[model samples]
Target: MRSQARQYAQSAQHRRAPPVRYSVAAAAVPIVAMVAAVYPVPMAVVVLAVVAVARYGRAAE
Candidate 1:
C-alpha cells in the first residue's frame, strides 16, 4: 500500500545518533588511591565519588 511504502521510506531515512563516549580515568585515579587507604572508608569519600562522577561525566565546555 502507499501508506506502507511511505512508512518504509520514513524508516529508511532515519539514522542513529552518534555515541557519546568518555572516560572518568582522571577522576577515578584519585578515588582509587583514596579507596586503597588503610583507614575506614568515610562518607566524604563517597560524596567525592558522586561529585566526581557528575563532574567528569560531562562534555567539557
Candidate 2:
C-alpha cells in the first residue's frame, strides 16, 4: 500500500510539473525583456518566446 501511494504521488508530480514549468517559463518573458533593456538580451527573449510558443502548441495537442 505504501508503494502504491508513492507511485501515485510520483505520477501526480509528473503530470503537474510540465504545466508549472511551462507557466514559469512563460512568466519569465517580461523579465527577459527587462534584462534585455540593460544588455544584449533581445535574442534571449526571442529564443524564449519561440520555445514558449512551441511548447504551448505541443501542449495544446
Candidate 3:
C-alpha cells in the first residue's frame, strides 16, 4: 500500500512540473525582450523579437 502511494505521489509531482521546453528560448526570449523594451533599448527589443519569432515558428513547424 505504501509503495503504491509513493508511486502515485511521484506521478503527481511529475505532472505538476512545468514542461521542459518552457525553460528554453520559447519562454525565455520574450520575457527578456519585454524587460529590454521597458528599458527603452530599441536594438535589444528588435533582436529579441526576431529570435523569439524564429524560435517559436520553427517549433510550430
| Whole-model Cα lDDT of every candidate shown, in order | 0.56, 0.67, 0.64
Q: Per-residue error at 35 for model 2, in Å?
A: 0.4
Overlapping backbone residue pairs in candidate 2 total: 0
Per-residue lDDT of model 2, residues 11-59, tens digit only: 9778774455455555576777677777875686678776877678568
Best by lDDT: 2
lDDT of 3: 0.64
Q: In candidate 2, residue 60 scores what lDDT?
A: 58
Deviation (Å) of 21 in candidate 2 = 0.7
Clash counts for all predictions: 0, 0, 0
Clashes of 3: 0
Better of 1 and 2 by TM-score: 2
Give the C-alpha lDDT of model 2. 0.67
**What lDDT is obtained when candidate 1 is compared to the true structure?**
0.56
Descending-lDDT candidate ranking: 2, 3, 1
lDDT of 1 by residue, 1-61 (tens): 7699567645754763222332334436565667757567786876786666656555442
Off by over 4 Å in 2: 1-18, 42-45, 48-61
Off by over 4 Å in 1: 1-40
Error of 2 at 56 (Å): 8.5
Better of 2 and 3 by lDDT: 2
